[model samples]
Target: MRTLRRRMGLLVVPVLGLGLVGCCGSGERGSDASAAAAGFERAISTGDTAAVCAALAPESLSEVEESGKAECADAIPESRLPVGGSVRTVDVYGRQARVVLASDTLFLSQFTDGWKVVAAGCRLRAGHPYQCAVKGG
Candidate 1:
């Protein structure tokens, strides 16, 4: 009986350790997503084009810049930006994560930098998607 109890204890210790590790990892991911969302909100509020651009994905930046409709440095109006939203849910796989925000708009992509806004507008469109656009610096 003593030997059986000892063996169970050993198994329990490893299971508890693994559980702790999993919780820590999940917490870190949540913190990252929260920080990214907060940064985006703050940048938009302050009209910090640089901050906003920095948070964007590389391909997105290039596409917006090349389109010529708007530049990355443009200040986004308060109306166009999200006011309050929490990370409703976050799905992560490897270096990428997709976070669902509580705002009216929907942002896509699994970003290592958390959930950055890939696209936003009153309505999602195919060709002419509405996002923060700025002209020449």
Candidate 2:
């Protein structure tokens, strides 16, 4: 009986350790992505253009600057992205995320620093990707 119990303990310990390792990274990443999305929404509602610009991904900031011939901080508010309601849901996959608000949809990407907004004020189009007022492209 003692030998059988010891064998079971060996199997259980390794299984439990692997399970913990699998969950730890993913759980933290999901929460971090959601917080970044919520913070972006708050910046828009408060008319904090600088904060909004800071929340944008590098590619998105470049797109804004190139298209408007203005700095990202100056151009972000001028884009007039729809101010959606509170965040309803955040979905994360690998390095990408989608956040749904009451009146708008936002896409985000994970960077070395953290998550950043890649698109905002997006609407669905038949058989196409979302059409966004502010997008990385």
Candidate 3:
């Protein structure tokens, strides 16, 4: 019985070491995602369009630019100018992520840098574009 226990311990130790290595590698990726999300949030809070654009995926940035809006910074809504509240949560997967923010409204997306207010018209969605559904009537 003692010999059997020693064998099991040896097997378990190697397996646990491998698992730790795997976790460390994955953890690095997660940290990158978190950093990206934080950068995006800071840019939005400051209403710095250039910074925001820098944080966005290239394709999304081009789309906004092609719209012929003034400047990327100018496109931000007045209400969002003085950003308030905290980031409720951030969930990242690969190149995409969702950051739930605390505000009068809910912002959502599958942003490469994390969930962002690419569109502020409506609630959050995984794949669809943002739809501003604020009730103005």
Best candidate, TM-score-wise?
A: 2
User: Local error of candidate 3 at 8, Å?
Assistant: 57
- Per-model lDDT: 0.46, 0.71, 0.41
TM-score of each: 0.51, 0.76, 0.48
Question: lDDT (0-100) at residue 40 of candidate 3?
Answer: 61
Alpha-carbon shift of residue 87 in model 1 (angstroms): 2.7
User: lDDT value for candidate 1?
Assistant: 0.46
Stretches of candidate 2 off by over 4 Å are: 1-26
Please provide, for model 1 over 16-130, each residue's C-alpha lDDT reduced to its tens digit, 9 standing for 90 to 100: 2222322332567656755675666567667787887776666556644665455767534422545445556554334433344566332334455456555433232344332
Worst 10 residues of 1 by lDDT: 1-10
lDDT of 3 by residue, 23-133 (tens): 331355545544555666577677677786665454444545555365455544432433424555444343333344564222223444454433222343344333332
> Poorest 10 consecutive residues of model 3 by lDDT?
1-10
Maximum-lDDT candidate: 2
Please list the residue runs of candidate 3 whose C-alpha ends up more than 4 Å from where it truly belongs after superposition.
1-26, 76-84, 104-122, 125-137
Model with the higher lDDT, candidate 2 or 3? 2
Q: RMSD in angstroms, all models?
A: 16.1, 14.9, 16.3
The CA lDDT at 102 in model 3 is 66
List runs of model 1 lying over 4 Å from the truth: 1-25, 75-81, 104-137
